[model samples]
Target: MMPSIKFLRIIVVLSASLLFGCSDKSVDQAEFPPDKTAAVEVNGSDYSIEKGGYRWVRKKGLETETVTTDHASPNQMAEHLQPISVKSGQKVKVKIEDNPILNVFLWNQSGKEKEIKLEDDQITVPADKGTYIYEVLAEWKNGEISYTFVAEVQ
Candidate 1:
């Protein structure tokens, strides 16, 4: 009877430890593809940005897998989205859920692309009045994602 009771106690302890350990591991290894949220702020309004191409590395235990996807260009992705209105030369804020390195660019209708310098997570809208498409490339330690949004400067 004494031996049986000891054995039962050991089993219970091991079971609890295993369950807690597994849960910790799952939390450490984030979801296969992280859920990333991105947006643009214009005139105190937040506009969700469309996600574009991406190359990400997913890790599980000691193994890692690279996932790559190619999507339409920034202009193409913006075509379907209603342009967010902004004042010419106004500052537009880029809001992403995580702190990833960001590279921003603006595209004109004629297919010209120009990199925009970001200051305090904000970019100045094009001075000229017209519609413009923006591409934001965000890179984390484990992955990279491209986002797009269209803005019409009045």
Candidate 2:
């Protein structure tokens, strides 16, 4: 048994060594205490921080939920495209926002998935325009994400 002061000194030395880099002949595990790392959960993820317009994690096993920035805040985002409703054969110039990671899929009551091509962040929908219900899902780089935006096109 060693004095508490002496034990503390050994701990400090071991911590400094680990910070620089560990060696094959490692010190006693008791000397170096384990870090108290706690995961922050938010949006259904152990991570709760945003960086580079994306969510990140210090370790892997932790699953994270992600949503495209545009879809994440359609109401607050000015560039987000609002669902369009036009008369039959109206030929509206769909104004889509340009988002490289935004996966926009137009689904109608017909239960069909139509991937709309993005040009200038918008696409013209050639719907017959008869009170059609459509759902737009905007996906981000993270699969644990989805933005369900619905609109009625008449």
Name the best candidate (by lDDT).
1
Best by TM-score: 1
TM match of model 1 to true structure: 0.83
lDDT of 1: 0.88
TM-score versus the correct structure, for each prediction: 0.83, 0.33
Q: Give the lowest summed-lDDT range of ten residues in model 2.
A: 31-40
Q: Judged by lDDT against the true structure, how good is candidate 2?
A: 0.37
Candidate 2 per-residue lDDT over residues 103-145, each given as its tens digit: 4455543444566665543445455553332233333232222
Model 2 lDDT, residue 1, Cα:
68
Off by over 4 Å in 2: 1-100
Clashes of each: 0, 3
Which residue pairs clash in candidate 2?
96-121, 96-122, 97-121
